[model samples]
Target: MEKGKVVVLEDRVPKLKERRRQKANRRLIAYLSFFFLFILCVLYFQSPLGAVGHVEVSGNRHLTAERIISLSGITKRTSFWKVNEQNVEEKLTRHPEIKEATVEKQLPNTIAIHVREWRRIAYVYDRQTFFPLLENGRLLKQEGTKTAPSDAPVLVGWKDGDAIAEMTGQLAELPAAVLGAMSEIHYKPTREYEDRVIVYMNDGYEVSATIRQFADKLSHYPAIVAALDRNVKGVIHLEVGSYFVPYSPPKKEDGDETTSP
Candidate 1:
């Protein structure tokens, strides 16, 4: 060392000790935090807080919420972790009315069940009871109601067979406007036309059609009716050859009764 030029030595021991102390403190803090979190997790899982606290249902129309819940086998005491989503969904879809089912588990003990039910396309009347017909061609006889479902056509003379099932399935494809206008459907099978049927419309017009291609032809009803005189309550033939014939009465000429063709 030269005179008036002094070299200062660094205090590395204290600096190293301070760094170790800080690292130890940080490690201790991390350990304590992990311990507390572990204890909280254990307590949370063992307590009722982990149990299902709330359950919600959606997308149900004909079936009640209570009915859906009962089918799901979920209650207030059910553990949130114990609910098997796939099992519950399968159970709900077992019913004929439910088209699809979805089950979801939400955080903090909430479960939700959403279901899509088959649409009620029409109603069939049998033995003084009116039963709803689903879009899947299933007749809900056990779920019959005393009142007629005016929203859909009432099938009067349909019998339980493949023909009626096929007919109802076809009716499901009809548009809302045309289906609403049809009040009743009569199934009349003849030797010439085995699938002959008649439809009574609410618009003061009767429709003569067959089960085959009935929905496709009926879709043109609005446009066809628009071109004709609505005031004349006649029969609209929606068969192979579309035509309209008014309801005319017979006349007596020279004491001989004559009818107009």
Candidate 2:
């Protein structure tokens, strides 16, 4: 080998070692800085600066704020850095009535949790027991469960849990006047469609509709009723478009024609 080549080769080893040493030093400094920051965090969290002094909850209706906070295990004494948001969220979500929960930190000592609760739209009857079904498609306790809203529709013969989706959808599309006039809903599980709903109106009339077409048809009930003579009696047929036929009295009559409502 030439002398210059030999000298260059000899010089490269120390330079490589020095570079590795510098890299190692940088890594050590990073670790030390992280450790120091971690220590400071621990101290700060423990020193009342991170203690939860204020807790706020919003968007909760069915669930009480205190009950939700208790379930979350985040209290006034909870350390801000030590707060387990995921755990709190999971705990809040354990109740099927809760649709969603979001936890947010307000400041050094404040935590806010927003929760959306599932609203019960209808009640399902399994035999004689009536179980209230939430909008998210969960059945509440049947035996001695809390009373649902007085205006909520009572569902008869509907056990398929998926019916909740249709019920919610129909309710969403219905105008408030027609919706408030509804007294009962009978979910007839027909071979054609399980979502068929037979409604009993407060006006002593029955409505035939599938959940698919209920909202649209019900919304137009006012116009349909307006066209009909109120003196005539019959259930308003809405399964298709608006049609009103006179109610036939329970007797065998040959030529008797009833007036249309």
Candidate 3:
């Protein structure tokens, strides 16, 4: 032994302990790596990480969820990460009955779809069955045997493209008071007067006007009715402007109030 050099009695013991520590670390790393690989396999094949399980639908009115989902062609096999949300929405919205559709992906395995359905503003009579006219003025194909719907008015006019849109615009602009008072809308589209429209009000008064000015003209109806006698039953011509033609009344003596035209 050299002078000033100290030797520890447990040299071999220290080396043995260091080798044990290294082995423990290697085992721990191996265990952690195995766990990581196992998790990756589970996620890749058996886990719900990419599977679709829940389908939530919202904002639908006319069309049911099942119908919309079927139309969209989205299935449980659809992978959430690989789904084309816009394509799904486009498929659902292609139908005239569907106004709008939105698709969203939830975590794990869930999907949500929100849809806005068209509103039926009127009905187009097809001899036996009447197809509903949506608020956008698009007419749907007749689906059933239900006769006149007592709820909304029946549209009688040239049944074709953009007709429903025109009618819907007019209906949307109608005053709540007049709309509540209206019974029917007679659509008489003609070359002589392209925008002609006639409506039968619940108060037994007739409204004849062009749709071009229908909204503005109909707004003055309550005042027009208020200024006239309740017994007056005739056509209120809002076609050119506000004018009332009374039904022929019995000629009265000079003392009676002079009736309006």
Clashes of each: 0, 0, 2
Sort order, lDDT high to low: 1, 3, 2
Scored against the true structure, residue 9 in model 2 reaches a CA lDDT of 67
Question: Model 2 segments beyond 4 Å from truth?
Answer: 1-44, 47-50, 126-130, 142-148, 159-181, 188-196, 202-205, 222-234, 245-261
Q: Weakest 10 consecutive residues, lDDT, candidate 1?
A: 249-258
lDDT of 3: 0.77
Off by over 4 Å in 1: 1-25, 248-261
Residue 14 of model 3, lDDT score: 86
lDDT of 3 by residue, 5-79 (tens): 876768778898999999999999999999999899778655555667878899986678898889888777777
Q: What C-alpha lDDT, on a 0 to 100 scale, does residue 115 get in candidate 1?
A: 96
Q: Residue 123: error of model 3 in Å?
A: 2.5
lDDT at 90, model 1? 98
* lDDT comparing candidate 2 with the true structure: 0.76
Q: Where does candidate 2 have its weakest 10-residue lDDT segment?
A: 142-151
- The TM-scores, one per candidate, come to 0.79, 0.59, 0.64
The Cα local distance difference test for each model comes to 0.87, 0.76, 0.77
- TM-score winner, 2 or 3: 3
